[model samples]
Target: DQQVKQNSPSLSVQEGRISILNCDYTNSMFDYFLWYKKYPAEGPTFLISISSIKDKNEDGRFTVFLNKSAKHLSLHIVPSQPGDSAVYFCAARPVGADGLTFGKGTHLIIQP
Candidate 1:
């Protein structure tokens, strides 16, 4: 099954603290992973991605780590800000697929 799971439906963090979001997958064929941030009405925007060949990837304040053996991944946001409050979705695609399978979503709330 092409299922990506985000166990937590939401998270809250104080500004300037660290925010951590988790994801898990059951599909062994997924070789590429991505994290997207979304606002209420707009579509998700790509945040960070990691290939199966790599263990981690980072971009500015965002970082993603993948554990292929465990079929798990996480995204970390350092010095979280109110602007960072949004829905985060973890997605995965097999090597040849054109689309991604996304988790339901995790709403990140950054309290001022």
Candidate 2:
């Protein structure tokens, strides 16, 4: 079974608005969570991440929140731009594991 899941297959938002992406995981041992963005025919690039010890993490125009108790996580993108349009993937890693478990991905489209 997949450890990480992105329930939404795609989302559309107007430029300069906010885009919210959600993810859920089945493992409690996952201590690190990451969000990666990928363009078609390319590899995923690491966006932002949060440790289990942190409930929230923020970067310029991006933020990630974790709810350990609920076994869920979410990503927020502010002032969405057309350049931000891509497939976003949610990934999780064990406390000291070398590999990551990834969700299918959610396609985000920024409308003009």
Candidate 3:
């Protein structure tokens, strides 16, 4: 199966705190992992990504960590802001497709 699972459909955090989102995949062939953030009525924007060969990747306020052995990955947002409130999707794909399998999504709320 190509399912990527985000068990929690939502998360809430206060501004200035850390926001962590978790995801799991059953497909061992997936070698590329990515996270995308979306605002209302807009397409998801790529946030961070890591290859199966790497364990971590970071960009500004975002960081992504992948554990190949467990087929798990996470996204961390530091100093969360109300502006960060939106849906986050975790995606993965095999090395060549460039196409992705996505989780249902997590609605992250950053409380002011």
lDDT of 2 by residue, 1-112 (tens): 9899999999999999999999999999999999999999999999999999999999999999999999999999998999999999999999879999999999999999
Candidates' RMSD to native: 1.0, 0.6, 1.1
lDDT (Cα atoms) of all candidates against the true structure: 0.95, 0.98, 0.93
Candidate numbers sorted by lDDT from highest down:
2, 1, 3
Off by over 4 Å in 1: none
Q: Backbone clashes in each candidate structure, one number apiece?
A: 0, 0, 0
Question: lDDT per residue, candidate 3, 1-112, as tens digits?
Answer: 5379999999999999999999999988899999999999999998888989899998999999999888999999998999899999999997677679999999999988
Instruction: Candidate 1: give the clashing pairs.
Output: none
1 or 3, which is superior by lDDT?
1
Report the number of the highest-TM-score candidate: 2
| Model 3 alpha-carbon drift over 4 Å, by segment | none
| TM-score versus the correct structure, for each prediction | 0.96, 0.98, 0.95
Q: In lDDT terms, how accurate is model 3? A: 0.93
Which structure is stronger by TM-score: 2 or 3? 2
Clashing pairs in 2: none
Residue 82 deviation, candidate 3, in Å? 1.0
lDDT score for residue 82 of model 1: 95
